[model samples]
Target: MGLRNYLSDVASGVKSLLTGMKVTGRLFLRHHKEKITQQYPDNKDTMVYPERFRGEVVMPHDDNNEHACTGCTACELACPNGTIKIITKFDVTPEGKRKKAIDTFIYHLQLCTMCNLCIEACPTDAIKMAQTFEHSVFDRSQLIKKLNQEGSKIREGVE
Candidate 1:
Protein backbone atom coordinates (compact mmCIF):
# COMPACT_ATOMS: atom_id res chain seq x y z
CA MET A 1 0.00 0.00 0.00
CA GLY A 2 2.90 2.44 0.76
CA LEU A 3 4.55 1.73 -2.59
CA ARG A 4 1.25 2.23 -4.38
CA ASN A 5 0.72 5.63 -2.70
CA TYR A 6 4.27 6.71 -3.57
CA LEU A 7 3.74 5.76 -7.24
CA SER A 8 0.47 7.68 -7.36
CA ASP A 9 2.16 10.76 -5.92
CA VAL A 10 4.97 10.53 -8.47
CA ALA A 11 2.45 10.12 -11.28
CA SER A 12 0.50 13.17 -10.15
CA GLY A 13 3.72 15.19 -9.90
CA VAL A 14 4.70 14.18 -13.47
CA LYS A 15 1.24 15.13 -14.73
CA SER A 16 1.53 18.61 -13.15
CA LEU A 17 5.01 19.05 -14.64
CA LEU A 18 3.74 18.08 -18.10
CA THR A 19 0.84 20.50 -17.82
CA GLY A 20 3.22 23.34 -16.87
CA MET A 21 5.57 22.46 -19.73
CA LYS A 22 2.68 22.45 -22.22
CA VAL A 23 1.58 25.92 -21.13
CA THR A 24 5.15 27.18 -21.40
CA GLY A 25 5.60 25.70 -24.83
CA ARG A 26 2.35 27.25 -26.02
CA LEU A 27 3.44 30.67 -24.78
CA PHE A 28 6.89 30.26 -26.29
CA LEU A 29 5.39 29.55 -29.72
CA ARG A 30 2.90 32.42 -29.39
CA HIS A 31 5.72 34.86 -28.64
CA HIS A 32 7.04 34.49 -32.20
CA LYS A 33 3.63 34.97 -33.90
CA GLU A 34 2.07 37.76 -31.83
CA LYS A 35 3.37 41.28 -31.16
CA ILE A 36 1.74 42.02 -27.82
CA THR A 37 4.41 44.37 -26.50
CA GLN A 38 4.04 48.07 -27.10
CA GLN A 39 6.75 50.71 -27.26
CA TYR A 40 6.23 53.75 -25.01
CA PRO A 41 6.59 57.39 -26.13
CA ASP A 42 6.46 56.30 -29.74
CA ASN A 43 3.10 54.62 -29.22
CA LYS A 44 1.78 57.11 -26.72
CA ASP A 45 -0.78 58.33 -29.22
CA THR A 46 -2.25 54.84 -29.62
CA MET A 47 -1.71 53.57 -26.11
CA VAL A 48 -4.83 52.40 -24.34
CA TYR A 49 -5.33 51.75 -20.67
CA PRO A 50 -7.52 49.07 -19.14
CA GLU A 51 -11.13 49.79 -18.18
CA ARG A 52 -10.56 49.73 -14.40
CA PHE A 53 -7.43 51.88 -14.42
CA ARG A 54 -7.25 54.20 -11.41
CA GLY A 55 -5.52 57.54 -11.91
CA GLU A 56 -5.62 60.88 -10.11
CA VAL A 57 -8.76 62.13 -8.42
CA VAL A 58 -10.59 65.11 -9.95
CA MET A 59 -13.77 67.05 -9.28
CA PRO A 60 -15.78 67.80 -12.39
CA HIS A 61 -17.83 70.98 -12.73
CA ASP A 62 -20.43 71.79 -15.36
CA ASP A 63 -20.33 74.71 -17.77
CA ASN A 64 -21.90 76.93 -15.12
CA ASN A 65 -19.11 76.03 -12.72
CA GLU A 66 -21.48 74.03 -10.55
CA HIS A 67 -20.35 70.82 -8.84
CA ALA A 68 -22.02 68.15 -6.70
CA CYS A 69 -19.83 68.33 -3.62
CA THR A 70 -21.77 69.22 -0.50
CA GLY A 71 -18.79 69.55 1.84
CA CYS A 72 -19.95 66.51 3.82
CA THR A 73 -16.36 65.31 4.50
CA ALA A 74 -17.26 61.72 3.67
CA CYS A 75 -14.54 61.46 1.06
CA GLU A 76 -12.05 63.14 3.31
CA LEU A 77 -12.85 60.76 6.16
CA ALA A 78 -12.72 57.68 3.92
CA CYS A 79 -9.26 58.36 2.52
CA PRO A 80 -6.82 55.99 4.19
CA ASN A 81 -3.75 58.15 3.55
CA GLY A 82 -5.42 61.52 4.19
CA THR A 83 -4.95 62.49 0.53
CA ILE A 84 -8.17 64.52 0.38
CA LYS A 85 -8.66 67.70 2.42
CA ILE A 86 -12.00 69.44 2.45
CA ILE A 87 -12.15 73.01 3.71
CA THR A 88 -15.75 73.98 4.22
CA LYS A 89 -17.38 77.35 4.69
CA PHE A 90 -20.77 78.41 5.99
CA ASP A 91 -22.79 80.38 3.48
CA VAL A 92 -25.88 82.29 4.57
CA THR A 93 -28.83 81.61 2.28
CA PRO A 94 -31.42 84.16 1.30
CA GLU A 95 -33.75 82.65 3.97
CA GLY A 96 -31.18 83.46 6.68
CA LYS A 97 -30.16 79.80 6.99
CA ARG A 98 -26.47 78.96 7.07
CA LYS A 99 -25.49 76.19 4.67
CA LYS A 100 -22.26 74.18 4.45
CA ALA A 101 -20.25 74.76 1.26
CA ILE A 102 -16.98 73.54 -0.04
CA ASP A 103 -14.27 76.16 0.21
CA THR A 104 -11.29 74.23 -1.04
CA PHE A 105 -10.84 70.63 -2.09
CA ILE A 106 -7.17 69.85 -1.90
CA TYR A 107 -5.70 66.61 -3.28
CA HIS A 108 -2.17 65.46 -2.51
CA LEU A 109 -1.08 63.16 -5.30
CA GLN A 110 2.14 62.23 -3.58
CA LEU A 111 0.41 60.73 -0.58
CA CYS A 112 -2.44 59.13 -2.54
CA THR A 113 -2.50 55.37 -2.95
CA MET A 114 -5.10 55.45 -5.79
CA CYS A 115 -7.26 53.07 -3.78
CA ASN A 116 -10.52 54.66 -5.06
CA LEU A 117 -11.87 54.68 -1.50
CA CYS A 118 -12.55 58.40 -1.51
CA ILE A 119 -14.46 58.21 -4.77
CA GLU A 120 -16.55 55.30 -3.50
CA ALA A 121 -17.20 56.95 -0.13
CA CYS A 122 -18.58 60.22 -1.54
CA PRO A 123 -22.29 60.31 -0.89
CA THR A 124 -22.86 63.16 -3.33
CA ASP A 125 -20.73 61.66 -6.15
CA ALA A 126 -18.54 64.73 -5.86
CA ILE A 127 -15.25 63.28 -7.05
CA LYS A 128 -14.06 60.71 -9.61
CA MET A 129 -10.83 59.15 -10.84
CA ALA A 130 -9.55 60.97 -13.91
CA GLN A 131 -7.97 58.89 -16.70
CA THR A 132 -4.72 60.86 -16.72
CA PHE A 133 -1.55 58.88 -16.00
CA GLU A 134 1.09 61.42 -16.95
CA HIS A 135 2.36 62.53 -13.54
CA SER A 136 6.04 63.23 -14.22
CA VAL A 137 7.05 66.52 -12.66
CA PHE A 138 10.27 68.27 -11.75
CA ASP A 139 8.88 69.96 -8.65
CA ARG A 140 7.22 68.08 -5.81
CA SER A 141 4.87 70.99 -5.11
CA GLN A 142 3.23 70.48 -8.49
CA LEU A 143 1.91 67.11 -7.31
CA ILE A 144 -0.41 68.79 -4.81
CA LYS A 145 -3.49 69.93 -6.69
CA LYS A 146 -6.69 71.71 -5.86
CA LEU A 147 -9.58 69.62 -7.19
CA ASN A 148 -12.19 72.37 -7.16
CA GLN A 149 -12.06 75.17 -9.71
CA GLU A 150 -12.08 78.80 -8.74
CA GLY A 151 -15.51 80.36 -8.31
CA SER A 152 -17.11 76.89 -8.47
CA LYS A 153 -20.22 76.28 -6.39
CA ILE A 154 -22.45 73.36 -5.54
CA ARG A 155 -25.29 72.70 -7.91
CA GLU A 156 -28.78 73.79 -6.93
CA GLY A 157 -31.21 71.27 -5.33
CA VAL A 158 -28.39 69.02 -4.22
CA GLU A 159 -28.41 67.91 -0.61
Candidate 2:
Protein backbone atom coordinates (compact mmCIF):
# COMPACT_ATOMS: atom_id res chain seq x y z
CA MET A 1 0.00 0.00 0.00
CA GLY A 2 2.29 2.84 1.24
CA LEU A 3 5.95 3.17 0.12
CA ARG A 4 7.32 2.68 3.68
CA ASN A 5 5.11 -0.39 4.27
CA TYR A 6 6.07 -1.87 0.86
CA LEU A 7 9.81 -1.43 1.55
CA SER A 8 9.45 -3.02 5.01
CA ASP A 9 7.66 -6.03 3.47
CA VAL A 10 10.46 -6.54 0.91
CA ALA A 11 13.10 -6.26 3.66
CA SER A 12 11.23 -8.93 5.71
CA GLY A 13 11.13 -11.27 2.70
CA VAL A 14 14.85 -10.84 2.05
CA LYS A 15 15.62 -11.44 5.72
CA SER A 16 13.59 -14.67 5.73
CA LEU A 17 15.34 -15.90 2.54
CA LEU A 18 18.81 -15.15 3.97
CA THR A 19 17.89 -16.91 7.24
CA GLY A 20 16.81 -20.03 5.36
CA MET A 21 19.90 -19.90 3.14
CA LYS A 22 22.16 -19.67 6.20
CA VAL A 23 20.84 -23.00 7.47
CA THR A 24 21.26 -24.65 4.07
CA GLY A 25 24.76 -23.26 3.68
CA ARG A 26 25.75 -24.65 7.10
CA LEU A 27 24.37 -28.10 6.22
CA PHE A 28 26.17 -28.11 2.88
CA LEU A 29 29.48 -27.25 4.55
CA ARG A 30 29.05 -30.09 7.09
CA HIS A 31 27.64 -32.66 4.65
CA HIS A 32 31.03 -34.14 3.75
CA LYS A 33 32.12 -34.43 7.40
CA GLU A 34 29.03 -36.30 8.62
CA LYS A 35 27.59 -39.67 7.65
CA ILE A 36 23.85 -39.18 7.19
CA THR A 37 22.96 -42.47 5.53
CA GLN A 38 23.99 -46.10 5.90
CA GLN A 39 25.18 -48.53 3.25
CA TYR A 40 22.25 -50.91 3.56
CA PRO A 41 22.37 -54.70 2.89
CA ASP A 42 26.11 -54.64 3.38
CA ASN A 43 25.82 -53.28 6.90
CA LYS A 44 22.54 -54.96 7.73
CA ASP A 45 24.16 -57.53 9.99
CA THR A 46 25.77 -54.85 12.13
CA MET A 47 22.89 -52.42 11.86
CA VAL A 48 20.90 -51.76 14.98
CA TYR A 49 17.25 -50.93 14.77
CA PRO A 50 15.79 -48.44 17.15
CA GLU A 51 14.02 -49.90 20.17
CA ARG A 52 10.67 -48.37 19.19
CA PHE A 53 10.72 -49.39 15.52
CA ARG A 54 7.39 -50.89 14.37
CA GLY A 55 8.05 -53.90 12.15
CA GLU A 56 6.01 -56.96 11.16
CA VAL A 57 4.62 -59.53 13.56
CA VAL A 58 6.18 -62.98 13.97
CA MET A 59 5.36 -65.85 16.29
CA PRO A 60 8.38 -66.95 18.22
CA HIS A 61 9.53 -70.52 17.70
CA ASP A 62 11.92 -72.94 19.32
CA ASP A 63 14.30 -75.43 17.73
CA ASN A 64 11.35 -77.76 16.94
CA ASN A 65 9.20 -74.97 15.43
CA GLU A 66 7.11 -75.23 18.57
CA HIS A 67 5.74 -72.09 20.24
CA ALA A 68 4.63 -71.39 23.81
CA CYS A 69 1.17 -70.15 22.92
CA THR A 70 -1.37 -71.72 25.29
CA GLY A 71 -4.45 -70.61 23.36
CA CYS A 72 -5.13 -68.14 26.14
CA THR A 73 -6.82 -65.66 23.74
CA ALA A 74 -5.38 -62.72 25.65
CA CYS A 75 -3.87 -61.21 22.51
CA GLU A 76 -7.12 -61.55 20.60
CA LEU A 77 -8.97 -59.89 23.44
CA ALA A 78 -6.41 -57.10 23.73
CA CYS A 79 -6.45 -56.19 20.03
CA PRO A 80 -8.94 -53.37 19.72
CA ASN A 81 -9.27 -53.60 15.92
CA GLY A 82 -9.81 -57.38 15.77
CA THR A 83 -6.75 -57.74 13.57
CA ILE A 84 -5.78 -60.98 15.31
CA LYS A 85 -8.40 -63.73 15.03
CA ILE A 86 -7.30 -66.91 16.82
CA ILE A 87 -9.49 -69.94 16.29
CA THR A 88 -8.95 -72.56 18.97
CA LYS A 89 -10.00 -76.19 19.16
CA PHE A 90 -9.90 -78.73 21.95
CA ASP A 91 -8.13 -82.01 21.41
CA VAL A 92 -8.51 -85.23 23.40
CA THR A 93 -5.05 -86.32 24.44
CA PRO A 94 -3.95 -89.99 24.69
CA GLU A 95 -4.35 -89.72 28.49
CA GLY A 96 -7.94 -88.51 28.07
CA LYS A 97 -7.30 -84.84 28.65
CA ARG A 98 -9.02 -82.02 26.72
CA LYS A 99 -6.24 -79.61 25.70
CA LYS A 100 -6.78 -76.28 24.00
CA ALA A 101 -4.62 -75.63 20.98
CA ILE A 102 -4.79 -72.90 18.41
CA ASP A 103 -6.55 -74.18 15.29
CA THR A 104 -5.78 -71.05 13.30
CA PHE A 105 -3.73 -67.98 14.15
CA ILE A 106 -4.82 -65.57 11.43
CA TYR A 107 -3.20 -62.16 11.50
CA HIS A 108 -4.67 -59.47 9.26
CA LEU A 109 -1.72 -57.18 8.71
CA GLN A 110 -3.82 -54.76 6.65
CA LEU A 111 -6.02 -54.07 9.66
CA CYS A 112 -3.15 -53.89 12.17
CA THR A 113 -1.53 -50.66 13.31
CA MET A 114 1.48 -52.28 15.08
CA CYS A 115 0.24 -51.02 18.43
CA ASN A 116 2.16 -53.83 20.30
CA LEU A 117 -0.72 -54.24 22.72
CA CYS A 118 -1.25 -57.81 21.58
CA ILE A 119 2.36 -58.65 22.28
CA GLU A 120 2.15 -57.20 25.74
CA ALA A 121 -1.14 -58.91 26.55
CA CYS A 122 0.12 -62.33 25.51
CA PRO A 123 0.58 -64.37 28.68
CA THR A 124 2.87 -66.97 27.14
CA ASP A 125 5.00 -64.59 25.07
CA ALA A 126 3.51 -66.26 22.02
CA ILE A 127 3.73 -63.34 19.59
CA LYS A 128 6.24 -60.60 18.97
CA MET A 129 7.32 -58.08 16.33
CA ALA A 130 9.76 -59.33 13.71
CA GLN A 131 12.28 -56.99 12.14
CA THR A 132 11.18 -57.96 8.61
CA PHE A 133 9.57 -54.79 7.24
CA GLU A 134 9.14 -55.75 3.57
CA HIS A 135 5.46 -56.71 3.55
CA SER A 136 4.36 -55.11 0.28
CA VAL A 137 2.18 -57.30 -1.94
CA PHE A 138 0.01 -56.87 -5.06
CA ASP A 139 -2.89 -58.85 -3.60
CA ARG A 140 -4.66 -57.78 -0.41
CA SER A 141 -5.17 -61.38 0.63
CA GLN A 142 -1.43 -61.93 0.90
CA LEU A 143 -1.23 -59.58 3.84
CA ILE A 144 -3.04 -62.02 6.08
CA LYS A 145 -0.49 -64.49 7.37
CA LYS A 146 -1.19 -67.68 9.29
CA LEU A 147 1.31 -67.86 12.11
CA ASN A 148 0.93 -71.56 12.69
CA GLN A 149 1.96 -74.10 10.09
CA GLU A 150 -0.76 -76.43 8.75
CA GLY A 151 -1.16 -79.66 10.78
CA SER A 152 1.30 -78.41 13.32
CA LYS A 153 0.75 -79.73 16.81
CA ILE A 154 0.73 -77.37 19.73
CA ARG A 155 3.59 -78.02 22.12
CA GLU A 156 2.75 -80.23 25.08
CA GLY A 157 2.85 -78.59 28.56
CA VAL A 158 2.55 -75.18 26.89
CA GLU A 159 -0.23 -74.21 29.27
Candidate 3:
Protein backbone atom coordinates (compact mmCIF):
# COMPACT_ATOMS: atom_id res chain seq x y z
CA MET A 1 0.00 0.00 0.00
CA GLY A 2 2.78 2.46 1.04
CA LEU A 3 6.34 2.97 -0.37
CA ARG A 4 8.01 1.43 2.73
CA ASN A 5 5.62 -1.51 2.70
CA TYR A 6 6.29 -2.10 -1.03
CA LEU A 7 10.09 -1.93 -0.44
CA SER A 8 9.78 -4.39 2.48
CA ASP A 9 7.76 -6.83 0.35
CA VAL A 10 10.37 -6.57 -2.43
CA ALA A 11 13.14 -7.31 0.13
CA SER A 12 11.24 -10.37 1.41
CA GLY A 13 10.77 -11.63 -2.17
CA VAL A 14 14.49 -11.17 -2.88
CA LYS A 15 15.36 -13.05 0.35
CA SER A 16 13.12 -16.01 -0.61
CA LEU A 17 14.62 -16.12 -4.13
CA LEU A 18 18.16 -16.11 -2.67
CA THR A 19 17.27 -18.94 -0.27
CA GLY A 20 15.92 -21.08 -3.11
CA MET A 21 18.91 -20.20 -5.32
CA LYS A 22 21.33 -21.24 -2.57
CA VAL A 23 19.77 -24.75 -2.40
CA THR A 24 19.88 -25.10 -6.23
CA GLY A 25 23.43 -23.79 -6.36
CA ARG A 26 24.55 -26.35 -3.79
CA LEU A 27 22.89 -29.16 -5.72
CA PHE A 28 24.39 -28.02 -9.06
CA LEU A 29 27.86 -27.80 -7.51
CA ARG A 30 27.57 -31.39 -6.14
CA HIS A 31 25.94 -32.82 -9.26
CA HIS A 32 29.23 -33.78 -10.93
CA LYS A 33 30.76 -34.97 -7.64
CA GLU A 34 28.17 -37.68 -6.95
CA LYS A 35 26.00 -39.99 -9.02
CA ILE A 36 22.35 -38.88 -9.08
CA THR A 37 20.81 -41.09 -11.79
CA GLN A 38 21.82 -44.26 -13.61
CA GLN A 39 21.95 -44.42 -17.40
CA TYR A 40 19.77 -47.53 -17.67
CA PRO A 41 20.37 -50.16 -20.40
CA ASP A 42 23.80 -48.61 -20.82
CA ASN A 43 24.64 -49.31 -17.17
CA LYS A 44 22.90 -52.69 -16.95
CA ASP A 45 26.08 -54.38 -15.78
CA THR A 46 26.32 -52.06 -12.77
CA MET A 47 22.62 -51.98 -11.95
CA VAL A 48 21.70 -53.76 -8.72
CA TYR A 49 18.12 -54.74 -7.99
CA PRO A 50 16.88 -55.26 -4.46
CA GLU A 51 16.76 -58.83 -3.12
CA ARG A 52 12.98 -58.76 -2.56
CA PHE A 53 12.16 -57.08 -5.88
CA ARG A 54 9.06 -58.78 -7.29
CA GLY A 55 9.39 -58.84 -11.08
CA GLU A 56 7.41 -61.80 -12.41
CA VAL A 57 6.04 -65.13 -11.24
CA VAL A 58 8.03 -68.16 -12.44
CA MET A 59 7.85 -71.85 -11.55
CA PRO A 60 11.45 -72.91 -11.02
CA HIS A 61 12.68 -75.93 -12.89
CA ASP A 62 15.47 -78.22 -11.78
CA ASP A 63 18.28 -79.59 -13.97
CA ASN A 64 15.85 -82.30 -15.11
CA ASN A 65 13.22 -79.75 -16.16
CA GLU A 66 10.97 -80.78 -13.30
CA HIS A 67 8.91 -78.30 -11.25
CA ALA A 68 7.79 -78.43 -7.60
CA CYS A 69 4.10 -77.76 -8.12
CA THR A 70 1.86 -80.49 -6.59
CA GLY A 71 -1.49 -79.05 -7.86
CA CYS A 72 -2.51 -78.07 -4.32
CA THR A 73 -4.63 -75.16 -5.66
CA ALA A 74 -3.59 -73.03 -2.68
CA CYS A 75 -2.13 -70.34 -4.91
CA GLU A 76 -5.24 -70.23 -7.09
CA LEU A 77 -7.49 -70.03 -4.06
CA ALA A 78 -5.32 -67.34 -2.41
CA CYS A 79 -5.23 -65.06 -5.48
CA PRO A 80 -7.75 -62.27 -4.92
CA ASN A 81 -7.85 -61.24 -8.62
CA GLY A 82 -7.85 -64.79 -10.03
CA THR A 83 -4.57 -64.18 -11.85
CA ILE A 84 -3.40 -67.77 -11.43
CA LYS A 85 -5.39 -70.78 -12.64
CA ILE A 86 -4.41 -74.35 -11.86
CA ILE A 87 -5.99 -76.98 -14.06
CA THR A 88 -5.35 -80.29 -12.33
CA LYS A 89 -6.07 -83.91 -13.24
CA PHE A 90 -6.07 -87.19 -11.42
CA ASP A 91 -3.07 -89.34 -12.40
CA VAL A 92 -3.43 -93.10 -12.00
CA THR A 93 -0.20 -94.42 -10.57
CA PRO A 94 1.09 -97.99 -10.99
CA GLU A 95 -0.54 -98.79 -7.64
CA GLY A 96 -3.88 -97.36 -8.98
CA LYS A 97 -3.88 -94.41 -6.62
CA ARG A 98 -5.61 -91.23 -7.75
CA LYS A 99 -2.76 -88.72 -7.43
CA LYS A 100 -3.40 -85.09 -8.23
CA ALA A 101 -1.03 -83.39 -10.67
CA ILE A 102 -1.24 -80.08 -12.44
CA ASP A 103 -2.21 -80.26 -16.08
CA THR A 104 -1.67 -76.58 -16.66
CA PHE A 105 -0.56 -73.61 -14.55
CA ILE A 106 -1.86 -70.57 -16.36
CA TYR A 107 -0.62 -67.20 -15.15
CA HIS A 108 -2.51 -64.14 -16.38
CA LEU A 109 0.00 -61.31 -16.04
CA GLN A 110 -2.59 -58.70 -17.06
CA LEU A 111 -4.63 -59.48 -13.95
CA CYS A 112 -1.71 -59.84 -11.53
CA THR A 113 -0.87 -56.89 -9.29
CA MET A 114 2.46 -58.43 -8.04
CA CYS A 115 1.19 -58.46 -4.47
CA ASN A 116 3.11 -61.75 -3.75
CA LEU A 117 0.01 -63.18 -2.04
CA CYS A 118 0.16 -66.32 -4.16
CA ILE A 119 3.76 -66.90 -3.16
CA GLU A 120 2.87 -66.53 0.49
CA ALA A 121 -0.07 -68.90 0.12
CA CYS A 122 2.03 -71.65 -1.44
CA PRO A 123 2.72 -74.33 1.16
CA THR A 124 5.55 -75.97 -0.80
CA ASP A 125 7.18 -72.82 -2.19
CA ALA A 126 6.36 -74.06 -5.67
CA ILE A 127 5.84 -70.58 -7.17
CA LYS A 128 8.03 -67.53 -6.66
CA MET A 129 8.79 -64.12 -8.17
CA ALA A 130 11.68 -64.34 -10.60
CA GLN A 131 14.21 -61.55 -11.12
CA THR A 132 13.34 -61.26 -14.81
CA PHE A 133 11.72 -57.94 -15.80
CA GLU A 134 11.79 -58.26 -19.61
CA HIS A 135 8.22 -59.55 -19.96
CA SER A 136 6.90 -57.09 -22.57
CA VAL A 137 5.05 -58.91 -25.32
CA PHE A 138 3.47 -57.86 -28.67
CA ASP A 139 0.27 -59.79 -28.01
CA ARG A 140 -1.80 -59.69 -24.80
CA SER A 141 -2.19 -63.49 -24.92
CA GLN A 142 1.60 -63.84 -24.70
CA LEU A 143 1.44 -62.46 -21.15
CA ILE A 144 -0.52 -65.53 -20.10
CA LYS A 145 2.41 -67.91 -19.62
CA LYS A 146 1.94 -71.56 -18.82
CA LEU A 147 4.22 -72.44 -15.93
CA ASN A 148 4.12 -76.17 -16.49
CA GLN A 149 5.05 -77.74 -19.81
CA GLU A 150 3.10 -80.64 -21.29
CA GLY A 151 4.22 -84.05 -19.96
CA SER A 152 6.57 -82.33 -17.54
CA LYS A 153 6.98 -84.25 -14.31
CA ILE A 154 7.17 -82.85 -10.81
CA ARG A 155 10.67 -82.70 -9.40
CA GLU A 156 11.76 -85.55 -7.11
CA GLY A 157 12.40 -84.66 -3.44
CA VAL A 158 10.10 -81.63 -3.87
CA GLU A 159 7.63 -81.66 -1.01
Candidate 4:
Protein backbone atom coordinates (compact mmCIF):
# COMPACT_ATOMS: atom_id res chain seq x y z
CA MET A 1 0.00 0.00 0.00
CA GLY A 2 2.87 2.36 0.87
CA LEU A 3 4.68 1.68 -2.47
CA ARG A 4 1.43 2.23 -4.43
CA ASN A 5 0.79 5.51 -2.55
CA TYR A 6 4.38 6.69 -3.27
CA LEU A 7 4.01 5.90 -6.98
CA SER A 8 0.68 7.84 -7.12
CA ASP A 9 2.30 10.88 -5.46
CA VAL A 10 5.19 10.86 -7.98
CA ALA A 11 2.75 10.60 -10.89
CA SER A 12 0.68 13.58 -9.58
CA GLY A 13 3.82 15.73 -9.15
CA VAL A 14 4.96 14.94 -12.70
CA LYS A 15 1.53 15.84 -14.11
CA SER A 16 1.50 19.17 -12.27
CA LEU A 17 5.02 20.03 -13.46
CA LEU A 18 4.18 19.11 -17.06
CA THR A 19 1.06 21.29 -16.96
CA GLY A 20 3.06 24.32 -15.70
CA MET A 21 5.74 23.78 -18.40
CA LYS A 22 3.10 23.58 -21.13
CA VAL A 23 1.66 26.94 -20.06
CA THR A 24 5.15 28.48 -19.98
CA GLY A 25 6.03 27.07 -23.42
CA ARG A 26 2.82 28.47 -24.87
CA LEU A 27 3.59 31.88 -23.40
CA PHE A 28 7.16 31.81 -24.72
CA LEU A 29 5.90 31.06 -28.23
CA ARG A 30 3.18 33.73 -28.03
CA HIS A 31 5.56 36.40 -26.76
CA HIS A 32 6.78 37.05 -30.32
CA LYS A 33 3.31 38.23 -31.42
CA GLU A 34 2.04 39.81 -28.19
CA LYS A 35 4.13 42.01 -25.93
CA ILE A 36 3.11 41.82 -22.28
CA THR A 37 5.62 44.28 -20.88
CA GLN A 38 6.17 47.89 -21.82
CA GLN A 39 9.64 49.43 -22.01
CA TYR A 40 9.23 52.72 -20.20
CA PRO A 41 11.44 55.81 -20.94
CA ASP A 42 12.28 54.19 -24.25
CA ASN A 43 8.64 54.49 -25.30
CA LYS A 44 8.13 57.91 -23.77
CA ASP A 45 8.06 59.67 -27.11
CA THR A 46 5.34 57.33 -28.38
CA MET A 47 3.37 57.27 -25.14
CA VAL A 48 -0.08 58.75 -25.30
CA TYR A 49 -1.67 60.24 -22.24
CA PRO A 50 -5.34 59.41 -21.90
CA GLU A 51 -7.88 62.12 -21.41
CA ARG A 52 -9.07 62.84 -17.83
CA PHE A 53 -5.67 61.81 -16.44
CA ARG A 54 -5.05 64.18 -13.53
CA GLY A 55 -1.32 64.63 -12.95
CA GLU A 56 -0.55 68.11 -11.74
CA VAL A 57 -2.18 71.53 -11.65
CA VAL A 58 -0.81 74.18 -14.05
CA MET A 59 -1.95 77.67 -14.94
CA PRO A 60 -1.94 78.34 -18.64
CA HIS A 61 -0.53 81.62 -19.88
CA ASP A 62 -1.13 83.08 -23.34
CA ASP A 63 1.41 84.81 -25.59
CA ASN A 64 0.99 87.99 -23.59
CA ASN A 65 1.95 86.09 -20.41
CA GLU A 66 -1.40 86.81 -18.83
CA HIS A 67 -3.18 84.24 -16.67
CA ALA A 68 -6.80 83.93 -15.56
CA CYS A 69 -6.22 83.67 -11.82
CA THR A 70 -7.90 86.56 -10.01
CA GLY A 71 -6.48 85.59 -6.62
CA CYS A 72 -9.98 84.67 -5.42
CA THR A 73 -8.40 82.03 -3.13
CA ALA A 74 -10.98 79.52 -4.34
CA CYS A 75 -8.25 77.01 -5.15
CA GLU A 76 -6.61 77.55 -1.80
CA LEU A 77 -9.91 76.97 -0.02
CA ALA A 78 -10.68 73.80 -2.00
CA CYS A 79 -7.28 72.13 -1.46
CA PRO A 80 -7.87 69.66 1.39
CA ASN A 81 -4.11 69.18 1.88
CA GLY A 82 -3.29 72.90 1.94
CA THR A 83 -1.09 72.54 -1.14
CA ILE A 84 -2.00 75.86 -2.73
CA LYS A 85 -1.21 79.33 -1.47
CA ILE A 86 -2.30 82.58 -3.14
CA ILE A 87 -0.57 85.82 -2.28
CA THR A 88 -2.59 88.85 -3.36
CA LYS A 89 -1.57 92.44 -3.91
CA PHE A 90 -3.88 95.41 -4.26
CA ASP A 91 -3.31 97.15 -7.58
CA VAL A 92 -4.25 100.79 -7.78
CA THR A 93 -6.02 101.55 -11.02
CA PRO A 94 -5.87 104.94 -12.78
CA GLU A 95 -9.10 105.80 -10.96
CA GLY A 96 -7.42 105.00 -7.58
CA LYS A 97 -9.64 101.97 -7.00
CA ARG A 98 -7.83 99.08 -5.34
CA LYS A 99 -8.13 95.86 -7.32
CA LYS A 100 -6.96 92.50 -6.02
CA ALA A 101 -4.34 90.72 -8.14
CA ILE A 102 -2.26 87.64 -7.61
CA ASP A 103 1.32 88.27 -6.52
CA THR A 104 2.46 84.68 -6.12
CA PHE A 105 0.70 81.37 -6.56
CA ILE A 106 2.62 78.81 -4.55
CA TYR A 107 1.93 75.12 -5.16
CA HIS A 108 3.50 72.58 -2.83
CA LEU A 109 3.84 69.51 -5.02
CA GLN A 110 5.15 67.38 -2.13
CA LEU A 111 1.94 67.75 -0.15
CA CYS A 112 -0.42 67.62 -3.13
CA THR A 113 -2.31 64.38 -3.58
CA MET A 114 -3.44 65.26 -7.15
CA CYS A 115 -7.07 64.96 -6.10
CA ASN A 116 -8.24 67.53 -8.76
CA LEU A 117 -10.18 69.45 -6.12
CA CYS A 118 -8.31 72.68 -6.78
CA ILE A 119 -8.80 72.45 -10.51
CA GLU A 120 -12.53 71.88 -10.10
CA ALA A 121 -12.81 74.75 -7.64
CA CYS A 122 -11.20 77.30 -9.98
CA PRO A 123 -14.01 79.58 -11.17
CA THR A 124 -12.01 81.48 -13.80
CA ASP A 125 -10.65 78.37 -15.49
CA ALA A 126 -7.20 79.51 -14.47
CA ILE A 127 -5.88 76.19 -13.24
CA LYS A 128 -6.11 72.87 -15.07
CA MET A 129 -4.59 69.43 -14.56
CA ALA A 130 -1.53 68.94 -16.74
CA GLN A 131 -0.61 65.50 -18.13
CA THR A 132 2.86 65.54 -16.56
CA PHE A 133 3.34 63.07 -13.69
CA GLU A 134 7.12 62.51 -13.69
CA HIS A 135 7.99 65.17 -11.17
CA SER A 136 10.88 63.96 -9.01
CA VAL A 137 13.50 66.16 -7.36
CA PHE A 138 16.33 65.67 -4.93
CA ASP A 139 15.49 68.81 -2.95
CA ARG A 140 12.09 69.35 -1.36
CA SER A 141 12.18 73.03 -2.24
CA GLN A 142 12.40 72.14 -5.91
CA LEU A 143 8.99 70.49 -5.62
CA ILE A 144 7.41 73.73 -4.51
CA LYS A 145 6.68 75.68 -7.70
CA LYS A 146 5.18 79.05 -8.54
CA LEU A 147 2.54 78.57 -11.19
CA ASN A 148 2.48 82.18 -12.26
CA GLN A 149 5.44 83.59 -14.17
CA GLU A 150 7.30 86.76 -13.38
CA GLY A 151 5.54 89.98 -14.56
CA SER A 152 2.47 87.91 -15.33
CA LYS A 153 -0.79 89.76 -14.90
CA ILE A 154 -4.37 88.64 -14.82
CA ARG A 155 -5.97 88.26 -18.19
CA GLU A 156 -8.31 91.01 -19.24
CA GLY A 157 -12.06 90.48 -18.60
CA VAL A 158 -11.38 87.57 -16.20
CA GLU A 159 -12.98 88.31 -12.85
Q: Model 3: per-residue lDDT, tens digit, 1-159?
A: 999999999999999999999999999899988886789889888888887889888898777878899999999999999999999898787799988889999999988889999999998888899777877888999899899876787876665
lDDT of 1 by residue, 14-128 (tens): 9999999999899998997887777778998888877568889999899999999999999989999999998999988989999999899999999998999998999888889
- Candidate 2: misplaced stretches above 4 Å? 1-23, 35-46
TM-scores vs. true structure, each candidate? 0.77, 0.76, 0.86, 0.89
lDDT of candidate 4 over 1-159, digit per residue (tens): 699999999999999999999999999989889997889989999999987888888999999999999999999999999999999999887799999999999999999999999988999999999899999888989999999999999888998
Top model by TM-score, which number?
4
Using lDDT, give the best candidate's number.
4
* CA lDDT for candidate 3: 0.88
Task: Output the lDDT of residue 62, model 2.
Answer: 72
* Candidate 2 lDDT over residue span 42-110, tens digit each: 897898887667787778777677887777889999998999998999988999999888888999999
Scored by CA lDDT, what does every candidate get?
Answer: 0.92, 0.86, 0.88, 0.94
Give me candidate 1's TM-score against the actual structure: 0.77
RMSD of each: 5.7, 3.8, 2.1, 1.9
Q: Per-residue lDDT for 129 in model 3?
A: 92
Error of 4 at 53 (Å): 1.8
Evaluated against the true structure, the overall lDDT of model 2 is 0.86
